[model samples]
Structures are given as structure tokens and as C-alpha cells.
Target: MSRTPSFEPYEGPAGGWGSARSLGNILRREGVPASGTLVLGRQNKVDGFQCVSCAWVKPAKPLPFEFCENGAKATAWEITSHRCEPAFFAKHTVSELLGWDDYHLEQVGRLTHPMRYDAASDKYVPVSWGKAVREIGQTLRALPDRRNVVFYSSGRTSNEASYLYGLFARLYGNNNLPDSSNMCHETTSVALPPAIGVPVGTVALDDFAKTDCILFFGQNPGSNSPRMLHPMQEAAERGVPIIAYNPLRERGLERFTNPQSPTEMLTHHETKLASQYHQVKAGGDLAALTGICLAVLEMEDHAKQARLPPVLDHDFIDTHTHGFGDFLGWLRTQGWAELERRSGLSRSAMTATAEVYARSKATIGIYGMGLTQHRAGVETVQMLVNLLLMRGNIGRDGAGICPVRGHSNVQGQRTVGITEKPELVPMDRLAKQYGFEPPRETGLNTVEACEKILAREVPAFIMLGGNFVRAIPDRGQMEPAWREIGLTVNIATKLNRSQLVPGRISYILPVLGRIEQDVQNGPQSTSMEDSTGCIHGSRGVRKPASPHLISETRLVCEIAEATLESNPLTPWKDWASDYRLIRKSIGETYPEIFFDYDQRMWEPGGFQRPLPARHREWKTENGKANFITPKGLAEDKDMPEPDEDALRLITLRSNDQFNTTVYGYTDRFRGIRGTRDVVLMNRSDIARLGLSEGDRIGLRTASKRDDVRRELGGLTVVPYDIPAGCIGAYYPEANVLLPIWHYAEGSKTPAAKSVPVHVYRGPAAA
Candidate 1:
């Protein structure tokens, strides 16, 4: 077991010691840091694999060190020399492994071969590819109602793998294709397309250099996407104003020391990131952003009265947008008093933010899960877009909307049709091109999938990649519900906790990681779509960890072949042999964007998928950009009043961890070390609750649903720079306190960042 680390106040910038420690962790695990550098250096390059970390856009000109701390760690973790053979599993049973934490279980090593759970032996045993696939195929083929099976995709799977996976699921029967995006960016996907007619972000990475201002709403690029720090630093040096809107004062947005700069490395210098920071209350971004828009309107009226040029973009509104009059009418009716109360910020701050937006000719807005994982997540995303549309920021240099994606290919997965709703992709095209009738109905999302499993409606669960149970809320219900499934299949590199909690029958299919080469078509190349809508080729550099491992592309094809009994009509074997064939099929599927797929991906910077909004050509129902005018702020009127002792809970990630993947129990940026069981609160709240900084406290959640007691016990309190009524804790740990139904209304994403709870000085639970 790993020893608990010690904590100290981390006063240094983000990329110094914390970065060094991340690389050192790989060295300690591999006994040498030199081995992974060559592979890491090639990340996000022309002939290299995509970074298996966050989905920040790669620079047009590749940096010398394109990989960040977490990117390197993912490499080191995947390319380690150690192995988890069948003998290892024979020694330790699934029950025994379940007792270990996520870090300890993954650190055991990678699975070397396909394995199946042996009920009598109470351990996993090695099984050949042929037998395992055949058995699984037989079971699936025997099913009476095919909708009982659900396929889950992850962000790490390449585009070719994802396209084939989606096609297979639809052809087989149901459109029950849930992906990691369901839990992360489903709000962005659902909200953007209606207003702008495209779900992808409109901004390119190159836009960072020329934007006059940047408004960051609920995102922390310094920790989540470290590569973003370089461009942000450049923009900062260029005197581009940056405005930050968040509930807590994130260390990332405060400042950054670019590790790549020689002067900063030598002199320990830092670059200021956020020029203006406002701590918007929890679930208060909708009100705050609306206030900014209101301020812009007020500025325009004042300019008109003074006989100055109009602040609004009349040409863009007249030519490329709709709903302006209605939006203007609603803006006039808004109450500034209620907005101030809901936003937790004075009118001065909101007006100041609006001045920055109005004066700047072009601005790029970047956001993260902070705005999306809420009761009105879709509203907040659309509102941010509405603010940009007023100034005609959509189709200009250094101006557009950017939602920093969490996974490397979360956007790509959606691009290639890994969605539960297949209506987004034309069914006629799929049917005509693939020679199969595809399912047209909407299917279960991540939340609905869990609910189906709980109700015993879904019998089989096949995961392409991901830590399923660990990333969701209501873990107490999800864990037991997973076992009710008839079969569970996992395709993964590392041994995650999800594999331990299995259905009645389970199988573990070892697959090649992105850094590992696939020899099926003589070093096959995979493609991915970055956050900026750029599609690039990604070819693995390292050899497979074990010879038994198969590529995800080939594995999906084999399963389909086995289940369908080798259909002559389907070109599964041909497509599996050469990935270019799959690319050809993908081009035919989405001709407008993916035309000449194999050749276009070979370009040095890769090709960007055509964005209609980027050219100021809105493809909405009215064929113009929309100005969404809601009835008013729903969260403001509908949000229940918290008790005097209640605190609004915001779940966060430690700097040392990824989504559900714990690199270590240390958040060095936050001065958190040695433990994940701690709560961050304001000093005033600690005093009000009669608790000390290191006091062990119990948090009882305030929920309107579910009668079960929801509490987290024995948490150490740490003083943080945040609003008094708000508190923070690491997610998945606090996920247990959430009721299953506490999610966004339209998107169905769990409202992980905003939960109502109260801290008490009482007996600890754990």
C-alpha cells in the first residue's frame, strides 16, 4: 500500500514542484524516468499517438514537450514493465482486490491476458480469445429482446473503434449506446446545437493568440489542461484581459509559471492569468452571466444617448441572428435586485465584467463541468453563447465558445456516433451505406442506463473503456445494481474497480493502449477529434504490454463477427484488417465533414471539421444564430432556501487525480496531502460551526429525495478562499451523499458540483 503523504502550503506556481513530483512518481514506479520520454515527446505530434489526458486543443505548431504531467503519468502507467498475469489473480481473489483502493488495485499492474471469473475458484482464470468471444457471442445471440443489452463507450477509444462500436450496436438492435460524455459534456452537446446548430466548440486553439479578452466561466485550465497554460500565458503577455467567474478562488486561475520558458524556469517568475476574478456563488453562474449580458445592454443604451456608435452588432443581428427583439424585451424585465441576490456579487462587478466584454472586439469564452453539472446546466451553456452572439464573436479571429473537454476524445466519441440518441446521425445514410437497418429510437443515457440496470431491465453491459461505477453518483445503488446484469464485459488497460464488481458472469478483455502499436494492418493509425473540432491521426509508438492484447478496433469487429455468425453482407473482416477501410466507411457516413478521411488526416496540423457557425452561417431551424430568452432565471426562483446551518457543496478533483483515476491522494495545488478524506471550507464557517482547521466532522446532506441517510464522516477541515456558505470535497468520495435523482433537468448529468449539505460536530461514521 502507498504511504500517506504530508501537506504544506503550496505557494509556488502550478508547473514547478508538482510537475516534478508527477514525473518522479513514474520513475518510482518504473525505476527509470528515461524510458517514457521518447513516447511522451511524440504525443499530439504528426506521427504520434494522441495524449490520453484532457482534450485541450493541440497547438498548430507542436511544442518541444507536448506532454504535461498527467499525460506523462498516463504513459508511464500504461507502459510499465510489470504485468498482472493469471497467476497474480490466482493468488488474490476478486473479493480480496475489492478491499483495496483504486490506486492500489491499478498499481498491481496490467492484465496480460483475457480472463473470466471462475465462481467455484473465486478467482479470474485465463481464457483464449476464441473461446471467450464465442461464449459471449452465443449468449448475446440467444437473447430474446436485444434491447436488454447496453454498450458503453469511453473517451479513450479511437474514432475508428468508436464508429464501428456504434454501428455494431445499432445493427444488432438497440441504440442503447451510452458514453463517458453522458456524465461530462452532455450539457454542452445538448445546449449548443439548438442555439448555434452545432454541438462542437467554435474556437480553434489558434484563437487564443488574437482574442481581445477571455471570459472563463467555471473552468480551471492550470490543473485540468496544463498545456493550455502556455497559450494563456501568451495571451496574458499580449495584454488580453481575462475574467474568471467561479464559486471558489481556483489556484490555477490566479497565476501560472510557464515551465517551458527559460527565464521563468531560471528566475522563478510567474505570469498573472485572471485579470479580474469574481467568486460567483454555487449554482449562481446563470444569474451572474445574465447580469453580464444585462450590463452589455445598459452600456449600449448609454452609448446611444451620448450619440456614440452602437455597442451591439447590428449587422450580425440583422444578417445572421434571430430572436433579438424578444431577447431585448426579456432583458428589460429582469430584476437587478434578484440577480444580485442570486449571484452573490454586487452590480458593480457584473457591470465591470460587461464593460470588458463590450469594449473588446473579439472574446473567447471557455468553460468546464462547473457550469454544466447543475440543475439548469443547459441554460447556463446557452446563456454564455447568448452573451457571445450579441457581440458577433462566433466567426472571427480569437473569438468563439470553448468548452474544455475532460477526456482526450470525449468530443471525438460524439463525432463518430457514440451517442444514445442516434437521430443526431442520419439513419437513412447508415442504412444505405452499411446495408443494415439501424435503430432510430433514442436510448438510455448514463443515468438512465444505471436506472435500467437497477430495475433489472438491462441484462448485459459491455464497456469499451472507462471506470463506470466510480464516476457516477449514487454509488451505493450503482454497485449492487451492476451485479444484477446477466453479463459484464470490460475492455481496458489497467485493472479498475468496475471490473471487481461484476454481473452474474463477467469477462475481462485486455486491449492495447493508445501508446501501444497495433499490428493488425502493419502498424495501424487511429484518428481523434480534439476540443477544437480538429481531426488528426494518432499512431501508437510502443509495443503492446503483452502479446495477448488486441486492438479495440479488432476486438469490436471480432465480437460482432462471432455474434452475427460471420455474415457475408457485412465487411467486418475487411474493415478490421485495414483501418483505412473503416475510415472510408466513416467518410461515406458523414460526407460533409469527413470526406476523403484517410488523406485529409495526413495533413501536418490535421484538418478541422467544417463549422457553419465559424463562418457566420447558422444552420439552426430558422437558419440563423439564436438568442435564447428564457422565462427568466429558473434556478433563482426554483432554488430552495437552505437552512441557516446548511452549506452548498461543490465536488472537486485533486490535482494528483483524473476522473475516477487516483494518481495519489495528494492535491499539492490546494496544500492537501496524505489523504482524500478532507473538506475545504472558509475560516468563518469553521468558526461558526465550532470546528477547528483539523477537526474531524460529519457532513449530513440535505436532500429532498430518498429516505436513506446520506452522510460522510471523519473529514478533516482545511481553510480555503471561498464564499462562506459554500464547502468543497473530492468527488466519488462525496458521490455517496448524493441522491440518484439529483441531476440536470434536460441533460440528466449528475449535479456533482452543487449539493446541499450541512456540517456538524458529531460522531464520525467511518
Candidate 2:
């Protein structure tokens, strides 16, 4: 357990000495001090493994130390000297390990061998790979309906492995493939295709160089993607205006001092990032964005009256888009007073931001989960698209919609057919090439899968690389439901909370990490797609943590081989032994996208998958970009106005964490030390709630449903510079308060950002 946390204001910039010191401390703690630098030196290089962190775009020209603090921690965490062997499990039972925190569980180090749960002893025992695969195959084969099985993939998986995993699920007769994207950027994938003709971001790494302005929304680059700060700093230094709109003023958007810069490091000089920062209310992004567009239209109308040049891009709208007149008509109907009340921003600020967008020749719109993890996630993204469409930002150099994805290959996983919706991929081609009937019926997504599991409908669950139990919402209900499932299989490198909450029959299959060499056929390489739509090869340099570990591809192929009847056309053995064969098959599957896959992936910066949106070609039903209008300003149309006692909860990650993996107890950027169980509230809200800083508070979900009681207690209150009526808490801990049924309407992403809750003094409060 961690010590009690202490709060203080962070006075320094985002990076520089603080980041460097943090990295050094993590290395020393992981017992890789000297060798860690050597490992990090190879990260993100052409001939090296990709960083297993955020899917930030890698530059065409590389730097010597391209890895950031989070990347280094991920690498060190994977390459740690400590090991979780069979002997360790012999001493501690699953129930005992369940009491350990997430950080301590992962800190126990990498799993050395495949293990099977012995329910009698409540402990895991080492199992032979052959026996484990055979038994798992028997269980899967015994299932009455293939749709009852769920195959979940993580963003850390490579494209090749993800493709095989998807193919295996389909061949076994279902498309129930729910990946990490379902929880994060599914909104972007579902919303962008209709507007931009692509599911991924349109901008490349080089776009930042030519962009004259940047519109940043809801993403904190300092903790989530540190490497993004380097380019942001460069753009800041080049006089490019960066407009940031978020509920909290993140340190990364405020100012930054690049740790790689010697002069700045020595002088302690900081570069201001966001020229203008607007702290919009949580769940108010739709209203805020609508206000900006309305302000832009007002500016255009005023320009016409003054006989000045038109503010709208008439040529682009006339030539390549539809529904403009309707959009214009709706903008005129919106009232400014309502917009201000909902958005928590004054009209002058909206108009000023509109002026910035109208004056700049090119502007890139960037956003993250803050806009996605809401009830109006899809609409919010479409509104961002609406803003870009007005200015002809799509399909233009240095200007486009960029969704900063979380996991490294999340976008890549979708690209490789890891989706619950079969129509998203070329199912006919896959059926023809592999000689198997593909499942045409839509499959369950992450939330839907959980619903089925809770209903006792799911028979088996196979996880590729994530802590599913911990990552999902409504954990109090899900954990017990997860244990009730017939079988659960986890393929991972380290021990996580998901593994401890085992099913009736469970197996923990240890796999090689990204930094470990896979020697299936003399050494193998895997490909991953970055957030910018670039496909590159990653070859692991270090040896496996244990000789007992196997490659993810091999493990997936072996399971497929054991479960399904042998097919001459599939040739699972060939693909398992040589990844090039898998690439060749993928090339055949997506000839237009992955042509000459093996050879091109080895190029200096690899190659970019073609994005039709980048070339002014819309793949919509009418072959033109369409303007989408959201129904209302409130993200959740059904959400009743909160009472005076209610506050909107926004779940966020700390600097010492990535997704659900906790590295330590310190949130360096927020000046939170030694604890993760705390709530950041506006000073006014704190006072209004009759609470002071350091007061222990309890929060209960303000849900209409009466069946479940979701509450978190003993949380220390820390006054923060956030908007009133909004409070922030760390995710996974706060995920319990998010109702499982409350999610985005179209995308089905859990509405974690705008959960309504009531706060009060805890029993321990003085």
C-alpha cells in the first residue's frame, strides 16, 4: 500500500529536469538503471521495436532518444529483471493476490510460464503448452454457439497477430472481436467514415510542420503522449497559434521545456504552448463547438455586410461537400445565451477562437478520449468534423482531423479487421482466400460482451493483451460475473488484475513482449500501424524473459489449429512459422492498402496507408462529404439537469499511469504525491459542498436505476483550477461509478467523462 498523498502546486513546466529525473528513478526502481538506457536507445528506431506506449506518430527523421518518460517506463516495466515464476504463485493464492493493488501486481514482474488455475487450491500451477492448448480447444469446440465466445484484443498487439486473431475468430464462426478501441476511440472510427471517408486520422507527422494553427481539445499530451510535446513545442516556437479547449488547464498545453534541448535544460527556459486556453465544462464540448461554428457564421455574415472577403471556404464547400445550406440554416436558429449557459464560456471567447480559425490558412483539429468518452461522443466528433469542413480542412496539407489514439496499434487493429462489425472489413475476400464461410451477423462489442457475461450467456473469453476486468466500468458487478464464466484465457507478458479474477476454468498463457525476440523461423518481425496511418515493422532485440514463453502469433495459430478442423488452404503451420506468409496473405486480403507488404514495411519510415480523405475523395454513399448537425447542446439529451448537490465526474489518468496500468503513486504534473485515491474539485465546489482541501469525501452515483449502489469513499479532496460543477478522479477507481448502461448512443463507448454523482463528507472526515 502507498503512503498518504500530499498535494502542492506544480510550478515547473511539463517536461525537462522533472521528466529526466522520473525516468532515472523508474529505471533504478525496475533494476535496469544502466541497461535501460541501452534498451531505450533502440526504441522507435527503424531497426528496433516500437515503443509499447501511446500511438503517437513517429517522425520520418529520427532522434537518438526518441522514447519519452512513459515509453521508457513501459519498456522498463516489460524488461524488468524481476520475474513471477511458478514458485511465486505457489506461495500466494489468487485470493491473496487480489488484495494487491494494480501497481504492485504488475510490479511482481513478468510471468515466466503458462499456468492453469487449480480451483481446489485456489492457485495456478504450471501447465504444458500442448496440454493447455488441447484443453482450451476442447472447451471452445464444446461450446454450442460460436457467438457465445468473445475474443478481445489490446492495442499493444501487432497487425499480423491481430489479423490472425480476427481470422481465427471468424473461422471459428463469429465476429465477436472487441478490442481496446471499443473503450477509447470507437467514436472516431464510427463517426469519421461518413464525414471523411476514413476511420483513422488524416494528418501525418509532417503536417505539423506546415500547419499555421492548431485546435487542441481535451487531450493532455504531457501524461498521455510526451513525444507529442516535442512537435507542439516546435510549433509553439514557430509562432503557430495553438488554441486549447479543455475542462482543466493541463501543464502540457500551458508550457513545456523539452528535456532533449540542452540550452533550455540548462537555462530552465519554458516555451508557452497554448496561446489561448478555454476551460470548457465537462460534457459541454458539443455546445462549445457549436458556438465556435455559429460565431464563424456570424463573422462571415458581418464580412458580407462590410463588403469584405468571404470568411467561408465557398470553393471547397461548393465543390466537395453537401448539406451546407441546411447547416447554415440551423446555425442561424441557435441562440447565444443558451450556448453560453451550456458551454461555460463567454461569447467573446467563442468569437475570438472563431477569428483565429478564420484568419489561419491552415488549422489541424486534434482531440482525444475527452471528446469520445461521452454520451454525445459520435456527435462531438462529427461537430469537430463540421468545423473542419467549413474551412475545407479535410484532404488538405497541414490541416485535418487528428484523433490522438491511446494504444500503439489501436488504429492498426481496426485496419487489420479486429472489429465486431464484419462489414467494416472485406469479408468476401477473406472468405474466398481462406475458404471459410464468414459470419455476417453483427457481433457483441465490449459493453455488450460484458452484458452477456453478466447475464450468464457467454461461455468463454479470450484476451490477447489487456486487463479487461480492471479496464471496464461497473467492476463491482462485472468481476463476479467474470468468475462465473465457464472459461477464460489470457495471453500476456505480465500478471494483471484480470488474471486473478479467474473463471470456473482459467488459463494464464505467457507470451513474449514487444522487446523480446521471437525465434520461430530464424527470427520474426511484426508490423504495427501508428496513429498517423503509417505501417512499420517492429523487430524485437532482447531475448525472451523466459524460454518457456511463445510468440503471440504462434500461440494464436496453435489455438486455431487445435480448435478447428484442418484446412489445406489456411496453412496455419506456414503462417505460424513465418510471419512473411501472414503478410503475403494480408497483402492478398488488402491489396490496395498493403501491396508489397514485407518489402515496403522495412523502408526508412515504412509507408503510409492510403487515406481517401487526404485526397479530397469522399467514400460516402453520395461520394461527397456531408455536413452533420447534432440535435442539441447537451451531450446527453436524456440527462436531467443535476441538482445543486450533484457534480459531473470526469475520470482521467495520472502522469505515473498508462491506461489501467499504474506505475507509481505520484502524479508529477498535478503535484499529487504518494496516492491515487483523490478527487480534484473546483475551489468553489469544494466550499459549496462544505468541504475543505484534504477533507475526506465520499461520492455516490446519481443514477436513476435502483438495482445497483455505486459509491467510492475515503477520497481526499484537492482544490484544482477546474470549472465549477465538475470534478476529476482517476480512472479504474472511478470506473465503478459509471453505470454500465450509460454510454454513447451510437458508438457505445462508456460515458466516463460526464458521470453525474453526489459528493459528501466521508465518515473519516474531520
Candidate 3:
């Protein structure tokens, strides 16, 4: 058994509208005077920052208060008055700080300077920016091969920086880009390109405005992506059907009391968000989606005999799609009994959903990690596309696939070429445009990189910004694998647990945050991509928080210079100081898409990257969109049952937190105050286990042949209306129960949502 971590239980606000008020309260309670407070304005305009929470596309025109509850907390957390100056570091050693919880380590405030971990002194001492970059370059030079280096891009990176970073990595002679998306929506990336000839969302923000009905599958927009609530509110008010399907009954999906609208807030009025909510099983999404499609197919057959309009888009299928006969055959073989058992939805419920979908002129399907994080996640999304295509929903004003991303620029990063595998055309074109041959050999993804770290194959690690160590699945295995790497360099705005993983020689270099000014040696602006595939400019107005801080663009360039040594790749000699040359290179490489990127960005906001959906065009290999099929219903491996008393546990994020970092502890949405110890369980499950609502339980991983045992103890079980046979707990803490090898069958994304175990009583649970 792995040793239990010695730390306080995490207690944070459940991410939502009330989180903003809670954060403001915490700041005041902590004696950070209100007058000194800096409340950044709403998102979508100047002074308005991107919500640090989830990715909900910003409206073209700002709302009364564009910021949502979690977004407000994210802004306040970033603009907090708290600071972790040099004196604070002097008071605590790295070992001492290691004793602190993840929340305490970050809550102390932002780092003030470049720092290196001094092993002898056991504290992080400030280092100069020049020296820090030089050290990173030196480490890279020492690596036996360029392939030994792994470059990770977080979703938080702006488009311009991501472009520059990708260019630098390719120029440095490697394509080991294991990005944040791999951990979240790689399923969409892998499945979409094959199904639709695109790897990103096909829908745009304007498309939502035209959509008559939106089918939300396995998503919790209210807490996961609150900004979606605004669009959902608009659709709901317009009498559009918004059907939601998920195992858990998220309060955000039921109704939203918009804090942005004063009228609703003042009168305690709430807008009914979901037209119908279906409680599907944890891994039953694919069954539910297919069942809906089957219903539609049946309707289409009946309509044809009645001499009514063909329910299936015969014109679309014949002209712009393929594989219809094969898909139809598969649907015909599926029985209602099998569908109902796999989907956990009653036939009446399925019929209700099909009625909304069949009646709608055009419908939009939106899903989140709940669908994409599973073994059949990719196929589940493709099934939704199949249903939409039955009615010719693609290449229309109000339709297409919309995978709600968690990080802000996840989709953007993929668009700008942050990937382990780049297509031959893009790579060959890049080589032709840039003077160097791009690497042909595909590189490692998130799962592969973790294995490489464990095998001690990757010699160096460079992270733009992400709490990787904590964010990855299987904490016990990940921590040890992280320690085996030769070097780990982090370009960050603040220190995270990843910094202390002890990669032979490690450095945490401070950089400017998005809300801060980014002035190169010359005047230049940076570009970023939004969730909807819109590429725009991001200009930081405020000064860098500290004098020593540098922009990530300059730092990555310098590291490239240091690592390449005497054989520098291109005109990178001055690229660090001049960002326009970088933009110019990006345009040259992707001319058809990023044409005149520099000039176009100068206009109001920026320009949208063109897509076939926007112009109703299909760019598939067969000259038409394809109907894809799944090998199976789902892919989570069933574990052997433990003793009757044991329970399986899964982890999730709270409202006051993003990934692993905590801003404060108070889950207002669940009505639990000052605690992360509360476990969400079905009332029936509680009864079945002979446990009361407030009973304490110990969660243990089912025994395996490998002898790797995980137990998370001292959890307070609070009966919730969650789907039966499933449980929800906060992450990093519960991450221990997830096995590294227990991930998606093809995508390799850790199944953080469905780990099977035994929940029982006592300190043994801990």
C-alpha cells in the first residue's frame, strides 16, 4: 500500500455563481483589506478577463455581467492582494512547504522571482531570469537526443505563444508535444478528424443563436461551463428544447438564477434551463445516444410509408456523406431491451427526447468531459453526429458538434499545431515554408509521456503552464515517474506542486499572466484561439506583476537558443525580442488559414478561421461526411468485487477550484460549507450499504494482481441524488484510486469518473 499523504482535508466552494461572493468573503475574512482589492471586470471586453474557470464561448456583445460565479472567483483569485515575497520563502523550506496542502501552497499568493530548488538548504532561492533560461538551455544541451525532450502546452496559453512554442519545438528537431488536451478531450480530436475531416468544433458562437434545440449529453453546464448557461437561457426563453442527459442531476442543469441579470437576482427568479433531464448510467452515454438515433431512424422509415417528407436527409446523405447503409444495418440489429439496459433510460424517456429532436428544424449537440473522458467517449460523440446528420443538421446555421472544453485555449492549441502527431501535409508544408524539414516520426502523447517518464526514456521536460503532476491520473504512480526524469523546467505565473517533483535539476521561472502586460523588446501583440476555433488577439494592459517576470514567448525562444547550442535552427537569434517575425512565420506555414494574421488582428477583435460548416461545405476524403460506428458500447474495465463493505470512488472539481488548485473551501451548490470531505452518493446506495447520510466511509481500490492498493479514508458520505451505483468526490485526493493503466481503450485518457471500489466504515478507510 502507498503511504497516506499527511495533509489537511481539502474544503472549497463548489464552483458556481455563489463562488464569487464566497471568494470576496474569504479575502475580507483573511484581513486582505477590501480597499486594496482589485476586482477585474467581466469577461469579453477590456478590464474584463477570460473566466479562469471553464470554457464557455463569450458572447459577441457582453451580458449585463458577462462573468459567471466561478469566473468571478477566478478573476478575484488572480487579482488578489496577497503576495508571496522573498521573505515568505525565507520562512519556509521546500520540505516545509511540501508539508503544506496544495491549497495553502498556492493560496499564499504569487511567486515574486525566478527560483531554483537548493537541495542542501531545502528552500527555493531566487535566481535571475538570464541564469534560469541559461540553466534550462544547459539541461537540454546535455540530453543525448532532442527526442528526449517533452514539451507540454496548457490550455491557458494564448494562441500566439502556442504557435511560437510549436514552431520552436519543431525547429529544435522534435515533435513530442504532450498537451493538456490529451488529458481532457483527445477523444474528440482523434474521432472528429476521421468522422468530419476536422479536429475542432464545427459550430461557431453565431450558430448557437440560430439553433432551435440543443441536446446536452453528459454535461453540467451550470458548474462545468457556467457561461453556457447564458446561451442556454437564450435558447430556453425562445422556446427551444434543451434536453440534458447525465448520470448525476447537476443543479446547474435544472435551473439557473443568473447573477449577471439583476432582475433575476433581485426577484429570486430562476430560468428553467433543461427542457428534460435524463439520468443515464456512468458509462451508458453511447447507448443513450444510439437509442435516440434508432428512434429517429424508425421515425424516418414510418414517415416514408406515409408519403410524408423523408425524416433522414436523403439529399445530404447522397451528396455529402458516405457509409449510410452500413450504419443503418447496425442500428437495425440493436434491440430495445439491449438499448434500455445499456442506456439506463426508460423507453418513454427515449421517445420524449426523439420527439424533440425529430420536430426540430435544426439541432445542436453539446457535450463535455463526461462523454469524452470514457473508453467509448470518441464513438459517443460520433453517434451524436450521426443523429444530427439523419436530419441533415451539418453545414447549416444552427447545427454541428460542440465539445465544451475545460481549459480556455485547448481547441486553439490543437489548431496552432500543438500535437504529438501532425498530418503529412501540414508538416511537409511547414518544412517548405520554414527552411527546415519537420520531424516525420510521431512523438508521445500524455499517456505515452507518463510511461516514458516511468521508463526514464524522456530526459527533459518543459511545461508552459499546468499542474501536471496532480492533474494526471494515478497520483501514486505519477509522482514516482515524475521523479525519474533528468530535468523539469516550468514557465509559470505562480508555483504549483509540479515544481517540487525533483527532476535532477529543476527551475521554476516566473512569467507574465494573460491579464498582465507582455511587451517584447519591440512593440508586438499576441494571438489566441477561442473554443469555437476563432483566432483573436490578446493584449495585456497591466504591467507585469514583478520586474523580474518575462513573457512566456521570450522565455521559450531563449530556451530554444540554449538547447540548440552552436547549431541554432533559424533567425531565432532575435526572435525572442521580436514577436511579429513569429507571427509572420505562423502565417507563412498556415497561409490559407492564418492569411494576413498580423493585419487582420489589428481590426476589432480578430478574424475567424474559415471552416466548411460556416460555408456549408464538406471537405471529407470521399468528398462527403462519413457515418462512423463504434466497436462496443463503452470501455471501462470491470474490477473484481471487493468484500461486501468496500466501495469504488471517483473524483471531480469544486466551484472554488480549477483542476487541483483550490481558491477556498465552500461548495455552495451542494449546500456543504467549509469541506471537501463530503462525498456525493445516491440515497438508495446509502441505504444498500447500511450507511447514514452523515456517516464516514473509507474508499479502497479493488485488489489487483499487481498488488497496488489505494485507500482514501475519512470521507464524510452525504447522500445526494446521484445515479445509483456511482459516487462523486473531489480530485487529487480521490485521484489515488484511479489506476494509471485503467484508461480509455484507444485514447488512453484516465477514467477519473468511474473507478470501481468498496466503501466501508472506520479509520481503516483512510
Misplaced by over 4 Å in model 1 are 2-5, 636-639, 761-766
lDDT of each: 0.85, 0.91, 0.74
Best by TM-score: 2
Which ten-residue region of model 2 has the weakest summed lDDT? 757-766
Q: Estimate each model's TM-score.
A: 0.97, 0.99, 0.93
lDDT of 2 by residue, 1-766 (tens): 7487689989999989999999999999989998888989889999999989989987668888998989999999999988999999999999999998899999999999999999999999999999999999999998888787999999999999999999999999998999899998999988998887888889988889999999999899999999999989999999999999999989999999989989999999999999999999999888899999999999899999999999999999999998888888888999999999888999999888999999999889999998999999899999999999999998889999999999999989889899999889899999899898899999899999999998999999999999999999998889989999999999998899999999999999999999989999789999999999999899998878999999999999999999998889888888899999999999999999999999989777769999898999898888999898887777665555666898999999999999999999889889999988899999999888888889888888887655588888889899999999999999988888888888887999999999989886774321
lDDT of 1 by residue, 1-766 (tens): 6567455777878786558767877767764377677777898888788888888777668889887877777778888877888889989998999888888888778778999988887788899999999998988999899986999988988999999999889888889988889887899988988799998799988888789999999988767888888888889889999999988777788888776677887888888889999999888899999999999999999999999999899998898888989988988888899899878899999999999899999999999999999888888999999899999999888999999998899888788888988778878998888677887778889989888887888879999999887788877777888887899999988898899998888999999998888888566999988889998898889978899999889999999988874556568988888999899988888998899898888687779998988988787899989998865676523334555688889898888787888777778788888888888898888888888878878788786555667788978888898887889998778887766677777898888777889787755763
Give candidate 2's TM-score: 0.99
| Candidate 1 lDDT for residue 576 | 87
Between prediction 1 and prediction 2, the one with superior lDDT is 2
